[model samples]
Target: MSTGKFIVIEGMEGAGKSSAIAVIESILNKQGIAYINTREPGGTPLAEALRDMVKSVEHQEKLTVETELLLMYASRSQLLANKILPALAAGKWVIGDRHDLSSRAYQGGGRGFEQSIMDTISDITLKGFRPDITLYLDIDPHIGLSRAKARGNLDRIELEQMDFFIRVHNKYRELAAQDKAIITIDAAQTMVQVHQDIEKVVIEFIAATDLD
Candidate 1:
């Protein structure tokens, strides 16, 4: 039996991930490919709850960095075991808004956790499971945050200092540079251009994987 592919759309807030997702879905639909859409720190019941807890700004005391990192992994573990793996085993592709890379960028970079610690936790949590293709929409933090703010109220993570997002952005570049599966798209470009780039990547991936 053929194993299904996993495609992850990763980037900072307002990096045009939603638009990219739409483009990918549209292409897959036209090609009659089957897929399930999901997001990390989310997707399962438990993961959604974790998402809320992590994003909520209602905590009386500041949430500890360790707690935040652990919750992210906990949510990811649930999503992977209860949703992602099963869908792939059933031969259905998965389209994810975010994935393990988020943790590496946000927790390891933005939050200043040691790379070794993040690697150990990730290795234990995911057992080396990774996306077959990652479309990383690269954008400057200032531009991304400006876009994010225009959309709605900022979440806890979104409310972080500009420097935090800079670190996150840098980490994304670092990780993408090292990983062949990740394709970096310049999100600072116009929407039309961004979508064009995304479609080009998706088409190539589909052809290579024979997903069509």
Candidate 2:
């Protein structure tokens, strides 16, 4: 049996990942493809719990950098083993809200962890497994944060200062540049245009590959 593809949508807070996912889903539906949607630091029950622990502002004690980084990987491990791998084995495409890239950008860049640390942990957890494609919605942090603020109360990560997001934004671009599997989309455009760019990418991928 053929294995299904994995598509990851990555970006800073309010970089229009949700909108991009919607566009991808629409394209998949039109093509009659099967896929399961997931979110990083989330997806499985255990992962969701980890997500809450990491993101919930209700926590009295602040988690250290190492602790937070490990938790993020822990959540990712659960999602991969319990959801992603199984779905792919069954020939179902996986559409993810965020994935391993988030850690590299957020913890490695935003938190200023060493690249070696990030690579070591990622290798341990993922063992070289990666998304077939990563759609990175490139957007200015100021703009993205403004949009995020309009949504509601910000999560712990979302509440980070401007410089933190700038680092994340830069790291995302740096990684995307090195990885050919990643596709960058101009997310600063109107939501309609963002969706169109996402659809164009998805359509091209579907047309070029015969996963079925």
* TM-score of every prediction relative to native: 0.98, 0.98
Give candidate 1 misplaced runs (Cα > 4 Å): none
Tens digit of per-residue lDDT, candidate 2, span 83-177 = 99999999889999999999999999999999999999999999999999999999999999999999999999998889999999999999999
Clashing pairs in 1: none
Q: What Cα-based lDDT does every candidate model obtain?
A: 0.94, 0.93
TM accuracy, model 2: 0.98
lDDT per residue for candidate 1 within 1-212, as digits (tens), equals: 57788999999998999889999999998878889999989999989999999999998889899999999999999999999999998888899999999999999999999999998999999999989999999999999999999998999999999999999999999999999999999999999999999999988888888543
The ten-residue window of minimal lDDT in model 2 covers 203-212
**Span of 10 residues, lowest total lDDT, candidate 1:** 203-212
- Cα lDDT of candidate 2 equals 0.93
lDDT of 2 at 5: 93
